[model samples]
Target: MAMNFFDQFDIPYILGTPLVIPALLFPVLMCLTTNRFLKNRHMTIQSWLLNKTTKQLLEPINTIGHKWASMFLTLFLMLILLNTLGLLPYTFTPTTQLSMNMAFAIPAWLMTILVGLRNQPTSSLGHLLPEGTPTPLIPMLVLIETVSLLIRPIALGVRLTANLTAGHLLMQLISTAVLTIMSSMTTTAMMALITLMLLTGLEMAVALIQAYVFVLLLTLYLQENI
Candidate 1:
C-alpha cells in the first residue's frame, strides 16, 4: 500500500542509490547542441528561440548590463526545460526541491546585490531606506526594508518550489483518483481522466510561466543593481 501521495514527489532512486543529481541532469540531455547548427532542425529552432528571448530580456537594460543577458537567457531555457520535463509521468521535479531552488536563487541574488553595491553603492543602500521618510519612522523602516531585501532569495526559491509542488500534488491526486475508480465506474473515470488531461495542459503552461516569472524577477533585480 502507498503511504502518501507526497511520496511521488520524493527524489527518486535506482537500485538503492539516490539520483538527485542524475535526475536534474537528465532533462538537460534533451537539448543537445549541434556544433554546426544548420544540420539539425531542433538545434536551429532552439538557437532561434534563445536568441529571440535573449533580445527581449536585455532590450531594456543599459549597455553594461547587456553582458549578463546570455547567462540569464541560458538559465531561463534550462529552467523551462526542467519544469516541463517534471510534468512527465514517473519523473522527479528538481525545482520542487527547496534546497535546489535556493542554491540557484541565493548565489544569483547575492551576485546581483554585489554588482549593485560595487557599481552604485549609494543607490543600492538607498534601497534599504526609502526616500522621504520621517525621522521617527526611519529606523523601523530601514530594519523592515533590510529584512525584506535579505528575504528576496528565500522568496524566489519558495515561489518556484511551492508552485511546482502544488501543481505536481494536484496532478498526482487527480490521476490516482482516476485510476482507483476506473474499474468500478467507467463513465465517472472517463470524465475524471478528461479533466486530468486538461489539468495537465494547464500544468505545462504553469511550468513555462513559472520559469519566465523566475527569470523575469531576476532580470528586474539585475536592473536595479546595474
Candidate 2:
C-alpha cells in the first residue's frame, strides 16, 4: 500500500469505537473510585472535603472539584491515549483533528459556564461584567466577556490540534528523509536514523506535556468560573 502523511487521517471506526466511549468511561471510573475511597473511610462528602487536599482546593467550587476532576482526568487519559496511539505505526491520532479537539474542549468550556450558573445563578453573568464598572461601560464589558467566553474552546482546540499535527508531520518528514537517504548514502542514512530516533523520543515527551497542558487549562477555567 502507498503511504503518506495524510493517509493516517483515514482511520476507520465503528459507531462506538471513537474516543467518546473512553471519554464517557472516565467520569464513571472516577465516580466509582471516589465512592470506594469515601466508603473505605466512612466519610461523607462534607467530611471528605474537610479532610482531603483535592476537596480543599475545590472548596470555593461548591464541592464540584471531585466531579470536575473526574472529567478532567478522563479528558487527560483520552488525549494521552489518542496521542500515544498516533506514535504507533499505522494508527491515527484523533487529537490531530480540529473536530476531535473541539469535541474534547467544547464540553470543558461549557462545563465551566454550567458550573458557574449552578453555583451562582444570580451572579454568574456578573462574572463577565465585574462589579463597579461605570454604567456606560456595561455594553463594552458584556462584549468583552462574550468574546473571552467564545475564545476558550477555540484556543483549546487549536493549541492541541496544532501541536499534535505538527509533531506527527515532523516525524513523517524525518522518516521519509531517512528512507530516501538509505537508498543513496549509508552514512547519511545512519545519521538520519539517529535524528529520527531522537525526534521520536521528543515526540513522546510532547505527547505527555500536551496532555498535561490541556488538563491544567481545563482546571484553571473551572477555577475561574466556579
Candidate 3:
C-alpha cells in the first residue's frame, strides 16, 4: 500500500485530530517530566551544578534532568519513531507534513520567547536592538530583528518537513527504479534489496540527525534568550 500525503490530513478528533497528536503530546510529556523532576527531593538547580563527585555528578544530571532533558528526549524519540514508522511497508509520517512540523516549531519558538520574557523582561527588547546605533539604523534594525524572529519558526518547520519529505520521496523513487531493473534480471533483485537496506540505514541516521539538530538549536535559543 502506498501512503497518501493528504490522507494524513483527515481529521480524527473532535477538537483537532491525530495529525497534531504527536506534536501536542511531545510537549505535554516534557512538561510533566520537568515538573516531576523539579519536585524531587535531591533534584535542585544548585545541586546540579555544585556536586562534583561521580555519584553527585549523576545526581545533578538527574536533578534538573527534567527541564531540557525532557524536551530533548521527547523530540528525539518522537522524530525517530515517526520516521521509522513511515519506513514500514505502508505508513505515513506525521513529521513529513508542514502543519505537523509547524506545530512543533511554533511551540519551540514561543518557548524561546517565553523564556526570554520570563528571565529578562526588561532586556528582552534589547535582543532585537543593538546597544548603540544611529536613529536611522534603529528602524532598519527593528525590521531585521522582526524578520529574524519570524524566520525562526519558519526555518524550524521547513527544515524538518523538507528533510523527511525529501528523504521519503527519494526512497520511493529508488525503490521504483530498483523494481523496474529487477524485472529484467534475477540478479538485480539482490542489488535492489541491498540498495533498499542502505537507504533504510541512511534514513534512520537522517531521522536522528534531524531530531538532534532541532533540539540543539532549540536549546541554544533558550540559553541565549534566558
| C-alpha lDDT score of every prediction, in listed order | 0.85, 0.74, 0.68
TM-score of each: 0.92, 0.73, 0.69
Better of 2 and 3 by TM-score: 2
Please give the distance, in angstroms, between residue 193's alpha carbon in candidate 2 and its true position after superposition.
1.5
Worst 10 residues of 3 by lDDT: 51-60
In Å, residue 102's CA in model 1 sits off its true spot by 0.4
lDDT of 3: 0.68
Q: Return the number of clashes found in candidate 3.
A: 0
Residue 204 local lDDT, model 1: 94
lDDT of 3 by residue, 1-226 (tens): 3465334434345455453465446545744665544546556753453333223212324333336655555565566666566676645576787887788889877987887788788777787888888898999998999899879989988998888877877777667767777768758776777887898899988887887677667766666665
Which candidate's TM-score is highest?
1
Off-target runs (Cα >4 Å) in candidate 1 are 1-3, 27-33, 39-41
- lDDT of each residue in 141-223, candidate 1, tens digit only: 99999999899999999999999988888888888899999999999999999999998999999998888888888888888
- The window of 10 residues in a row where model 2 has the poorest summed lDDT is 50-59
True lDDT of residue 100, candidate 1: 87
- Cα-based RMSD of the predictions, in order? 1.9, 6.6, 7.8
Candidates ranked, most accurate by lDDT first = 1, 2, 3
